[model samples]
Target chain A: MQNETADFEITLRPNTGWMQLDLKEIWSYRDLLFLLVWRDFVAKYKQTVLGPLWFIVQPLMMSVVFTVIFGNVAKLSTDGLPKMLFYLCGQLGWTYFAQNFNSNSATLVNNAGLFSKVYFPRLVVPLSSLISNLFTFCIQAATFLAFFAYYKYFLHTEGLRMDWRAVFLPLLVLQSAALSLGLGLLMSALTAKYRDLVHLSPLLIQLWMYATPVIIPLSEFPEKWRWVVALNPMTSIVESFRLMLLGAGTVEPLYLGLSVIFTLVVLVIGVLLFGKVEKTFVDTV
Target chain B: MSRPAIEVRNISKSYDLGSIGATSLKDELERLWKKVRGREVSARKGQFKALDDISFDVQPGQIVGIIGRNGAGKSTLLKILSHITEPTSGEIVLRGRVSSLLEVGMGFHPDLTGRENIFLNGAILGMKKAEIREKLDEIIAFAEVEKFIDTPVKRYSSGMYVRLAFAVAAHMEPEILILDEVLAVGDARFQEKCLKKIRAVAGGGRTVLMVSHNMSAVRSLCDHACVLHQGRLIQTGDPEECTETYLGIYHPTTESGVVDFKKPENETAWMKRARLYCDGQLGTQLEMGKPLSVEIDFESETEMEPGIGIVINGPEGAKILHASTRNAPSPSFRQPVKGGTIRCDFGEIPFTAGRYTLSFWFGGLSYDTHAEDPCFSFEVIERDLWGCARPYQAAHSILWWPAKFELQG
Candidate 1:
């Protein structure tokens, strides 16, 4: 049949432009993004002994462990704040980023079967994980607020106060999400080809948490090493989160600016790399 | 004239066969070392051209069949068309909302209920939430899983699971559909239903591209077909001719009436050789109503009594006859073990004049092993069994049956 080819809806070629992000296509698949998010939320807790309760229990347990090891045993500085509140607040931000990052990093490898057989926006997977992990973050944040309330009202612990900057909590969450997703996308793309990174990722994330001020506040680090920690995009987000909610840590404006810039750069690079990999990862993966 | 629904222009895909998934640091170091020493390194050496310079056009509402033997690049082409993988060279233009069913249940979670899976799978297949909701009841009814809609899919039988998955895929209303051997699953009746559903989809003026090894399905369902062979498009034309070409690729010329298979090194049981005889003479052509027999040689490692089977399939790969030693009323052979030859004699071959392939199966009571290929091929020549010189036409049936007609007067 002779017909005009200009009206073709899709043209698959050997080389697409490097900057072709296809954001409209991703937007068109918004319904799939929503369903994938819903699936993650519903399926994650299936057959669990405590169900979504594990969401709260996980961070609480991690906070207690951090309180015992870093706060009580090691007597690490908590920026003049109570150990439970300090670690819980830190856990609140760190858990969200780490959970999203871990899941997103495994997006390609874990869903290789699905990716091989279907065509949707590959970003939909990590983006849905970002949304799904936010649900967990909300529950953990509520748990942190309960502890913050107890220390502030009942215990009336010294130096514990919510400031006007607490409004920046949503911004901090967004920054943490961006950093996680960016790094996760980068890692997932590399791991699809390398596979060695799959084994190295968890260890890297663990070491990365130590580099950030998750267990101990940035104030406790040596002055010379402060710049190294500042280079980590997560450092300012975690510090600013504790500073806003607990009023115990110092937030440097320059480092906060640097964190934002770093996150944007990484996010752009991650999205681009992930886009490049998604097209051909079915063969390598 | 209407526009072509799909135009695949000189599409080719290649893979580094040696380096796929071999990305560990140690292997990289070894490869580097080999390269440094001027030794031939295989890591980047074996570039396999899976689909080489393949091109075709499909018009709207055309149910096109992609027929090929395994490793003939059928899957590579489908993957490229469906966007699961990218072609290394060339391009394709598609003029519709393309949906590919490379697998039936690509994203189904075992813990999710059938109803939930319907939504998830529908979304993965590019359907909007409203679309799935609109067809929810119809999907459930088609799958026949209404009673188990709310139950976890892992709890349902495999048949029900396949039914549900196919029902969800069948309900999708994409303008262009790419289907792999998805119809090869399910029972005969369900497969027939799926074929009918595909026909209905095509009847809606949508384009369908299907890759299937089932020659009968290809011939019956596809109006046009393309034959792929070793990463190349060898033939493209009418379905009947293309299917014949595809089948010919498998058994180009097996007129010797004898086949010898290499003995498997460590297999417990294996078929060794087979020979066909027409009227007690070694021949590849069997006349209708003439006596025919097949002699099979087999070997077993242990002292276990194993049964052997022979299957004759028509030119379109549809099974015509299956004769198994285990199904015989009396024990045909009482051999205990080792190696031997067993000859099966057919009283009178009743097949219509056509080419047929023969497949063999060897199995014991506990384990079964089948020969990977259809070991032999033979032709049945047309003959006038009655006193008249009139021959039976294949349009009537695949077999010739004798009948006596008498007037009641």
Candidate 2:
């Protein structure tokens, strides 16, 4: 008789961290994540009357509000650039960070139906949300670029200057994304227990926005207050925006360096907490 | 010996009970204060045991069946094995790639088409996008949804939706396949097709672990069955023996009668009484395949013409057969003695050994004239040697009857 046998024995280990993320198995399933992202984007506009146009409309309208409130009414300096361009850039950047964080924070809760019923990386939910948010970022960024060129040519002025530090834009984006993802992973884990994160989120976002230098320039502060403003990681990001794009401000190397350290620490803590929580979260979340 | 595909060792899972009694906002504040002071809190909290020290081994190519009721920790075990959730205490060693189809369409988005969701569901199941793309044609063909592959799944029929979902899962060939009751969807034929594929996968020296409540399905598909009850592993052995033990524990009775109908009787509009009035007699007992007529004696309290329907179901609420007399015209509306013995003749019985229930629905008369659950009782046994009932006619041929039949020409 011919006997056929299994090739290997099954073994269970604690967890596997591949690609610096939770749910490596889900990372293996990233095609599905891309599909889910496509689905999210399509579903958002599928039945809506305005469709993809709503993408540009949201940031465009936010820029209008910020230009009026901060530029004309409060008379905040736009670093010698057009108020619309300055406000629009800040809005786009802030929106990317906000959406990524908010969506990641909501990962477990929003996809509870799926998470409870199936076995996959729970992190996949938030990761897909980040990907979909990327769609919104691209749309807003393209709109801003068109306006930047129009203003530069029509106004007969270099409305937005270019600096070599612009090559490091990806690092700034990575920092912002990493910070939000870390905080989001942390908050999602906390949400399983407290169940009050949903109520506290908007309030937290308002306070966090004030902490960020989205509406104000970094140079406006006194040397002493600069330390406080630069304590926020985004102050380095926004300041770098002015330094690299408009040459109106200088980068805070000390503050930006601290922000990087803080980002790494937050991410490590987020992963540890999330790992601990995913093991037992089925009963709670 | 072949290497074992899955090894589970001393896995125990428990969940703490939530707060006792009604908790007001003030009580919550007081509780928080007590915690801050580091004082002794009440130890009246309870814990629910979902799985208690379950240990099992699945050798390569073994198709293992897990049979249990709801909250039996079947799903919990599957999650732990699939790594969706971790075991609280115990450890599991699994060999080769594992795919779990705990729920179909687990990550499906309503806006995406069948084509889009196929890739999405595949990826979630641990298949690469390129692999999914390569198998896209086969997946679409198996799902039989090529025509509407581009239509959003939200617009597809529930059958199509399940078919596409199952197809994606089927195409992702993992060394070990863990399925949790997803076969309950799709038609019987497609279910058979899926079962065949599972057998093929197992036959190819791969492992398959299935958690199912369908006793017959377990009997047919699993070489070995493990019974679980109330978070404890009760028994494990051959499929027939384990199922006998399981059914013995599950369907116990004081009267020693196999059938039990503790079904809550509906007080609203009903047939008054429904039972088999077969072979010119009215009896509570019945013989298998007995050309029986279910006589329903109903009376409409008010003058109304309502559509009457009957659905036959099993213990776990799976509808076996459902038909409605809604199309039949009742001309005697607004009259006395309007109801009679509505006899529906069945040539043969299609059931094996199991207790069954009867539920009737009265609809289309008024908004309030719906009989939600009119549960009653019936039974089927091994057939007799004498021909009592005619063959049950299908579109093609007669299904198998348990007993032998002699034809008198």
TM-score of chain A of each: 0.95, 0.90
Docking level for model 2? acceptable
Task: Identify the runs in model 1 with alpha carbons over 4 angstroms from their true place.
Answer: A1-8, B32-43, B255-275, B294-354, B359-372, B381-409
lDDT of 2 by residue, B1-409 (tens): 8557788899987776774222344556777888999977777478888899999888878899998867888988898887777766788988777888888887788888889888777877778888889999999999999999999889999999998888888877788889999778799899988888778878877789999988877888899989999999999989989887775555432221222223235533445555555443554334555654666656554444545677766544467777666444543233334455556665555554455565666533443344535345555444543565653333222234566779998
lDDT by residue for model 2 (A131-250), tens: 788778889878987887778778766646667877887677778788888888898777766666766776787788777767877667777788888887767776776566555664
RMSD of each candidate? 4.9, 7.1
Give me the iRMSD of candidate 1, please: 3.0
What TM-score, computed on C-alpha atoms, does each candidate reach? 0.87, 0.78
- Predict model 1's lDDT versus the native: 0.87
TM-score of chain B of each: 0.78, 0.68
TM-score, predicted candidate 1 vs. hidden true structure: 0.87
Give the whole-model CA lDDT for all candidates, comma-separated.
Answer: 0.87, 0.72
- Give the poorly placed runs of model 2, Cα more than 4 Å off: A1-10, A13-27, A41-53, A158-160, B19-30, B37-40, B255-409
Model 1 docking grade: medium
